[model samples]
Target: MHGPVSAAWLLVALCAATGAYCLLRMRSGVEEQRLSAGGEALMGFGMAVMAVPTAVFTPPRWAWPLYAAVFGAAALRTLWAVRAAPRHLHHLVGASAMVYMALAMAVAPPGPHHAHGGIGVPLLTGVLLAYFAGYVLLAGARLVPAAGSASGGGSTAAAGIRAGAAGWGDRPELARACRLSMGIGMVTMLLTM
Candidate 1:
């Protein structure tokens, strides 16, 4: 992630935490949730690893290709899963983006001017940035309880408390929050790339 060490560390924390939460979400009784959570967990952890500052530890020459291979496989898996549930399409996009970033890094190792120089394709990066930005906005909007729903003692706070009352894997709000955080983390990583 060729950036300030502090920003890198922050991204690591955000991604790792989101990954851990997704791991917990795998226990969901819902098969769809389990499948989606697994992919999201992989993405979160992968992003965390990739976000590590170059000053701290420079990955070996082979590492970038390995990343690409892993994410490419993930993208394939998501593609297959999308046949059953269209929601998995997002996972496919996320995995593909990861693959793109990995290949970009492999082509051009991090340097002072890597962001503007030879890191990633400008057009593709811009597309990804737009996609994730829109996703973050849409997800954030969904998180807010509707004004009408907030009436009848079903205020946003009350709804949140009810959602939190459920078990980890069953908490829809938490799951959405986890996804939202990952979206923000992805945007941050892409910007740094």
Candidate 2:
């Protein structure tokens, strides 16, 4: 978050809004949805906080380590949850990335812009950027309607559409889109770092 203040605030808004939506998604009757949404909400809010511009309010010296600790615990939780839901592995990666970012920020020099210096390993950031870039592409693809679908006059497809349109919490496509947005945001943050 060493960029312009406006960009930082924009990221904050995007992440906070996504976090709010994920909170609503937690109300879904599906247990898996609830679990995933909870984890996503955590990520969204955490990213928002981390994205805050340094000029606005720099966190205490201890805060970075706290962030690392919290995200490290989140990574562990996601690791355990992955046993029940394999998809939680993505959450694990997200949490681990957060931990990495936190540690990087912690070691960064204090100044007008917390220059990354050599604290953030270029290779690791490159790996994370590549991973999230691929994830964004894949999640975005999942949100797009498939070509040649028999939805022109198909009653089943129509009913399925109607069902998916019922509530935001139950819509798989929106959820995928949300994840895509987060992946993009992660890529942006990593680039700034």
Per-candidate Cα lDDT values, in order, are 0.86, 0.85
Residue lDDT tens for model 2, 1-193 = 6788898899888888888899999999777788889989999999999999888888987999999999899899999999887978888999999999999888877776655564554888899999999998888877767665645756544576676744658777778877887888798899888
Candidate 1 Cα misplacement greater than 4 A, ranges: 110-113, 116-121, 155-165
TM-score of 2: 0.90
Candidate 2 contains a number of clashing pairs equal to: 0
Candidate 2 overall Cα lDDT vs. reference? 0.85
lDDT of 2 at 146: 68
Q: Candidate 1: global Cα-lDDT? A: 0.86
In candidate 2, residue 76 scores what lDDT? 95
